[model samples]
Target: SLLVTSGPPDSSLQIWQVVPEDSADVIKCVSAIATENCTGQPWAKIATISARAPWVLHGSRLNSVRITDVESRKNVYVAGSSSSQELSGLAFLDCDTLLLCCAEGQLCLADVRHPQILLEAAPIPS
Candidate 1:
């Protein structure tokens, strides 16, 4: 299974499943999460991650990442970002470790199991 997040001025998160069919790889969208509610409220940023089972992390426009459970459809963890930091990319380094890049030139290493930032790096100004 794979999770993807995308938007252009607005964002959405989706989960996909990779299957083998006819000796080829086929990707299918299994779940589409609403980044906005009925009132048109934004829920996530343009970056997302599929951590361990049931734990899906979504970036928000408000400089924070929200961790939600696919099974319960509830929030589990919320990782806060700086005011100048907006999530630009997300990658899983391991089962519990994640790498997050920000638009403001910050690289953050976070733990998926808990709401803690293990490491962070910011680009030096020229």
Candidate 2:
């Protein structure tokens, strides 16, 4: 399982492993740097090693991204613009699926089945 983290920079997201409860050390197992703009509230989900990473950036509007577990400790998922629009609210349908509402009235479902596959990128009309 992973710990989802949001808020720090303007639009940032990250994840860390849930260390065993017995450990007295506070060492973080994993951390993800935001590659894209998540310009608002950040969302995260925990799946198996086969599970995907689904996150949301919320503010003026909602934007979200879905990423598969092709690589470990990689935050290859991002959603929304870092400009005036803000995103918030996040949920996952399954290990390979994600759901969220954008402030721009956009409802999205991203498939994290394959990271190498080219996905259709289009802004949902407000």
Instruction: Give the winner by lDDT.
Output: 1
- Candidate 2: minimum summed lDDT over ten consecutive residues — where? 55-64
lDDT of 1 by residue, 4-117 (tens): 544443455666778889989999878665553223444454434444555666664324566667666677765655444555666666766667776666787777566655
lDDT of 2 by residue, 76-100 (tens): 5544333333445545567555565
Predict model 1's lDDT versus the native. 0.60
lDDT of 1 at 1: 58
Report lDDT (Cα) of residue 55, candidate 2.
Answer: 38
Clashes of 1: 1
Leading candidate by TM-score: 1
TM-score of each: 0.57, 0.45
The per-residue C-alpha lDDT of model 1 at residue 22 equals 100
